[model samples]
Target: MSDNTTHPERCRCCGTMAVHRRLLDQDPGYARRRSRIEEHAFRAMRGTIVQRPGCTRIPVVVHVVYNTDEQNISREQIDSQIEILNEDFRKANADISTVPAPFAPVAADARLLFALAASDPDGNPTDGITRTRTDVSGFVDDDKVKADASGGKDAWPADEYLNIWVCPLSGGLLGYAQFPGGPAATDGVVVTYTGFGNMGTARAPFDLGRTTTHEIGHWLNLFHIWGDDGTGCSGSDFVDDTPNQGGANLGKPTFPKVSCDNGPDGDMFMNYMDYVDDDTMVMFTEGQVARMQACLDGPRSAIGEMVSCTPLHPKALPKDTPKEFTKEPIKDPPKERPKDNPKEFVKEPVKESVKEGPKDLIKDGIKDGGKELPKDNPKDFGKDPGLEPGKWKPLDPPPKQIFEVPTKQLVEGPVGGKQAFENPLPGGWGNQPVQPMQPMQPAQPLQPFVLATGQAPSGASLKPPVADGGGEQDQSQALLGEYAQLLAQYAQLYQQGMLDQQGMLAWQQAWAAYVQLGGR
Candidate 1:
């Protein structure tokens, strides 16, 4: 085996971009699909579309193509890779706390959950793994490792499962992935055995299983943070939030390193899309999440629609299957008792002998001169002697008392001969008539609702009203119309399975702010 100690440079670490270019050149259909996918991503990003509610579960199939015993990794290693994917994609990795304060706000949980497929293409129970003994010493980025004829195992259906091929990679290459628009036969990702997982035969600096995470990011339609411009300032990863970078950052780079005039908070080298080591890269941004969600909504929607994480037997039907076909026939209940047969239902009463105790307690009390109580009578309670039956007499009114108004008394004061109270309070409160209460001026008609710079307080755009009318009612109507349009768009995306919980919440907050501003 070649020396595993030497790490490849940032540009050569992943071969996804190279594979992408080759596919664009060789297949015309792939190029067209790539264009359409990009257009969809662009729309999603521009609209800031919310993701669908709940976690998206994806079934995975790992194909292990090995040439030696060491290359044939253990089940624990494969499981470790799956767990790492779950953590990294969901932003549940422990290292995520190390993200800088500035970038942490945009760091997002993709809400993508991955599990080993429970059933194979033929609906047979499976462990979600395939091991093939390959004679080829090492596989290149050319994709021979994806087929059985080329000394590798063929992929499962790409539309139903995410195919992962783990083998020894040639030319110091770590891994590569075929993007969403590629042919299904060669779809999915490939990782080197040493860089595939965190345990057994896994090597340092690459053992945390982030290689598969990064490649799957590619599979989910994410571009590198550096924008793949080959050390130029002109490239764009198509994500708006990520800082523009001239080239990929390799190894462990300190925070806030400037490039392409992106200063202060410079290139996001710690991003999973960059070439940093496993322990270094830790996050995916909200913009990247939107892009991936667009892919799930469009090109790759089928794989996530249904997921089975445990083996499924052929005889067992889905939960939604008709009950009549899946369950046993109903049995008749026992007969009810006949109402006419009252004699048979009745039981014989038992005779009881009464015992006397504390005899004549009431009579003894009466003999001791206890007063007898009156008999119960409705007329005896709540009766007023002064009031006639069915008639109420009004009480006489009390005599009114007269109050003497105070007259101003003369006192020695600085103002000559001015009538003043003998004792004057501070602030000119002496001997003055009480001021009549002033009516509150009708609350100053609320100032016209205006959004400064057309932005909500949360920094989301309010998307100005369509009409230019100066009337408040017209402006409010326009704003309401715009809000309604946004709601309609949100509902459509949600129905199409394009929105995730985070995206849905963000859009909800935005429209809620609009409503507060009198949109509706």
Candidate 2:
């Protein structure tokens, strides 16, 4: 305090002045915060992917809680933000007047869209907008907004709606978002108004308005365009076709400019997620969209659920107005899409019918022993029903969408690939090859059922059924005999008082008849 400016630095702990020691002795607040952030990241991976299909659209409520004057943004700007999201997620962000021809052809149209939610988490219709004034204003490290967990955003039925908080923070970091595991897992994305869009909250020129587009990209599980790898392209964001590049690009790159050893493609400097200055950014690739979708389907489905309301759509629903009436926008350089005549909000009601689903094997032919063996022929035991023995083994169905995402219903709601779960079987779901009953020889000679490595009593080799004899009745008789032994045991146990009493007498009579015909 003697002289603030020229005073030599000193360790607060011991007053030993040394430039290095003073710098090191500062509060250490930032480093501690970083450790906490990392620790929370570790907690996120223990999560689950969304597994159902055709879940309904999820609704979202944007609460713009502002304090400072700059944070004061208009609804139009917010609407533009939602529009950019729809185009980016849907992979339909076409309309290339903004991008150079060379890059236009390669632009990926993400398969997702956004809308002002039509209802609240309680299923009541809403304008999907809310405003609050908070002393909390300024830039933040994560997203520009969040559904506060404790009183801040209030505990939302997170699996049903996204709570976007537009507030200020003290960090210079761009924007940040949570990675799956869910709303409780991490705070929602946070962005600075100046960086939100070219339209709202931002100044012009710098506002070619893709900030929200970029931040929302992260919200959908996309990483930075440069892959955030210190090694760049070699580290990849795990996408299949995106060329790798070292670091992010700031102000736009002149055509044919090259950097990051990502030759040929040079740098994906134009990708929206890159750190490039506003006007320079142009597109998000299909590969990037897919990667994001994988996240949506896998660990982040809960967030995706915020898009749906019930067993149906989780969040962003489609326009009720016919496709022809809606405005088709993309993440084009700002002002490309007409923000003037915004489409009227359409609250499309979702319809679901639990039509008769296929009956499961367990519900049908299965018996006390799982399922009646096709006719105890020696050859039937453990053999694929005519399936090429080598070609078919147990396999999962191909992955499918957790939500019944109708590709054709692209007009209905947000079509995030993240919301899609791959059907886990080959040839997709319903095409599951029927698993024919295994061929186990007649009872007493075989083990009940077998595991992948389980063996049966020797002579596991089947004695094929005689072409003319040992009729179906004989086979049924043999199986019935086995059932009789089980029934007798049940009765004997009851007689010895080991079984529950009320039904004991009926069980005994059933056992007597069951054993009459060649009971084991």
Clashes per candidate, residues 3 or more apart or on different chains: 4, 80
lDDT score, candidate 2, position 260: 65
lDDT of 1 by residue, 1-520 (tens): 1112354533337888889878766886775567557645654554534446666899999999999999999999999999888878777787888999989999988878898999999999999999999899999999999999989899999999999999999878899999898999999999999998899988978889999999999999887787676677766676778998877777788988899998888988889998887889999998898888888987898886533323322222454577665454333222233443554545322112122323456557666544433443435564656367323222321222011112221123213444222122235433433333222223422111111011112211122322344565665456555545555444434433456766465455434434444543
Runs of candidate 1 exceeding 4 Å displacement: 1-12, 48-50, 305-520
lDDT of every model, 2 decimals: 0.70, 0.45
Q: What TM-score does candidate 1 get on C-alpha atoms?
A: 0.60
lDDT of candidate 2 over 1-520, digit per residue (tens): 0111231121001011111123224424322332222222211221111224433233566666677656767878887777656654444343334665566666765555456778777778788776656655453433224434332345355555565555554433334444333335333445545555447566543465566666666555555655554334434443434566765555557765566665664766778776666666667775575555555554445654433322212134455645645455433435743454333222222112122233444456465344445556555755645767433322321223223234433222122322111111124322223223234345423222211112221211211122255574665455454444444344333323444532443343333333333332
